[model samples]
Target: MSPIQDIQTEIDAHNDIFKNVDGNRSKMVKSLGSTDEASFLQQRLDDMNQRWGELKAKSANIRAHLEANAERWNRLLALLEELGRWLCLKDEELNKQMPIAGDLASLLQQQVHCAALQKELNEREQLVSSTLDQARLFLADQPIEGPEEPRRNLQPKTELTAEERAQRVAKAIRKQAAEVSEHWERLRANVVSWQEQLERVLDKLRELEGAMDRLELRLSEAQDVQTTWQPVGDLLIDSLQDHIDKTIALKEEIVPLKNEVRAMNELSGQLVPLDMQLSSITTRHLDDLNMRWKLLE
Candidate 1:
């Protein structure tokens, strides 16, 4: 027989077994009519009917609980499906991106977009986590329905069954949650790394700018001193050593600035065109200063 037909047949058999309960009780009451034991037997029948009603109430409660559980499961599946789809889309978008690179203004704009994405990711991650928590709370409930004595006997088995079902769903949820979290972490790490890189580049650019400015200013000051320099014969006898030491001092300063120019030049190619131009200008300035110093020395 088909499963549905077999189930209907079983239900029909149960109905047949109980179909004569009311009639038998009535017939026995009539048979014992007017006897002192009649009242006692009637009372027993009434009590049995009350017990049956209570059982039916319990059955109704359990049915309602099962229906509610089904509804919750539906909602959980819908939410998980929605959350998973979003995570997948966002993950794909992030994967297609290369590292943030380019000029300062462009990198800064990318940094801003990365920050916004990071914030959105945090909010969505929390929503996913909250949905997972709600699913867990719903699954934590048992769906057993019956009298205490009978249900107590099967309580362990029922709990184990519920636990088994919950564990199965939990496994799926956990896997999805892990995948979602993995996506979030990967994206967040990318943003952080890109931001860090941008910061380093900007910092390097700033440092190079400062070094170039200092070198230029020192060269200007040295040129000024050169203009005031006196020839040995025109200087006092003791001022000879002092004038010679000025050239030595100037060389010492130029040596460090030359090294600074070289260092900045090496890094400029990897940075931006502006940095390369700045380095180039500084190199020409240093070359001019060195030539002037050589003639003076």
Candidate 2:
């Protein structure tokens, strides 16, 4: 069956269900009669009536949809038939065969399939969009009713006698006092919240300030160390003198009052030991000097 026919069939089935519900309600009501003992039966009847009403509404909506789809499909089919007839007339007049019939048939089938798919997609898109709109509205927490009536408008305002006016004034004063108290309470609450937030922000700022102070102190210490190390640059050439003397002493070993040199006796071997010690000390001093210079720079 066609899509439109299928929709119509479904509508018909829903309508049948609705009608059967009405019969069930009537039968239950008749069997139970009008008595408190029949309350359960009456309740069932009322539920069935409500269900039938809802089903009837659904059926009506489905019927409308089916009719619309049927009309559209019919119009499209009629147009396709007209086009087919036109193509046949054209082929007869041309008196030529260029596989136009097969091409036209294929194109027509594709167009029909596309139209069907598009219609289905549009219906699904509409349903989804509607559902999404409903969900958004539900989540938005919007008010369901109009604004409340003004407090003063709850009862009409009127003039009063002198004594009544005094009573009214007293009542007004009490009401104003209550309103002021409430307002002050709200203000105090807000102030407390703001104070808490301010305290947190102040604590964070203080922490940052403390960190900055520590960094400044370290920077000052580094500067002092740098100042202390500045003379090293002037003493760089003089520092090499100690290395040179050590080298020369290894070369001209005249005094032998220290200990016996029996293990190794080459000047080159003595030079290696002196050079290694000099290199290690020089490396430490140079690294320290470089670090201080970098800090100063």
Candidate 3:
């Protein structure tokens, strides 16, 4: 059966015991009215004493159960709090790394843009080579031209042989190609460095995700334990309260009985030991109940 059902069964059993004890106490009080029946009175007193012992044992068991439950609850609470702190720390660490992840994303976008530009540059270089080839074919068809004099027109100009002009143009294109190559190399290196950084950041993020998953599992388990034990805790508290009330009522019941026994003892001079034993048992159980209350607190 369920835990709640088990607790209800225990309560019902205790209630039955309480009814029985109250019934026995009433019988003992009625027996006390016939003081002349010494044998019957002694038997009744012995039965009451036995009942008191049973009650004390039951109370002790209940108290022990309560104490153990309290300790377990306290430990569970501590575990839950510790898990909460760990989760908070993990969250803070993840937040701190978010900026780095964002920066890596930006770098990747720039790298993609740089790659597109590089592709365009390669296409332009191919077009330039094709133009140069066409120009060479056209020049070869014409006769070689000799060096010409400098022209003094709207713009000052230096005339040169075809070969010299071709050499200069080729040299400038080679220099431009070299500069583009160097820029591409530098850009490539930066991209590689950013890629390495991104990998490391991704690794850290994966580790954080794993840690968070484990913490979440632990947190969920703790929550389940808390949920499952809550009803048991409530039942224990109710039982404790009932015990306290019963103990108080029993003490009040015992007071009048003890007084009556004491009066009977003076008359019979034989009931002193039983009265003293009952007092000691009552006192011990009261002390135990008090200690249980302290533990509960």
Give lDDT tens digits, candidate 1, residues 1-297: 222223334545655444577559888888988897889989987987786666556545644554556546656767777777887776676554445443445556656766676687778877877886775565445332223223334555555433234334555555665565566567678767765765776666666556556655766776787788887679998898888898788777667656655665555555653322333454575466556545544
How many Å off is the CA of 199 in candidate 2?
1.6
List candidate 2 stretches off by more than 4 Å: 1-163, 231-233, 238-297
* TM-score (C-alpha, index-matched) for candidate 3: 0.30
The model with the greater lDDT, 1 or 2, is 1
Give the runs in model 1 whose Cα sits over 4 Å from its true position.
1-17, 20-23, 28-41, 65-73, 100-106, 122-133, 142-253, 258-297
Candidates 2 and 3: which is better by TM-score? Answer: 3
What's every prediction's RMSD, in angstroms?
Answer: 10.4, 34.3, 61.4
TM-score of each: 0.50, 0.25, 0.30
Clashing pairs for model 2 are none
lDDT of 1 at 58: 58
Cα lDDT tens digits for candidate 3, 134-247: 444433433334444343342545564233344334344444444444544454455455445555544443443344344334334434534443343456755877656654
Collision pairs in model 1: none
- lDDT of candidate 1 at residue 247, scale 0 to 100: 76
Which 10-residue window of candidate 1 scores lowest in summed lDDT? 142-151
The global C-alpha lDDT for each of the candidates, from Candidate 1 onward, is: 0.61, 0.42, 0.44
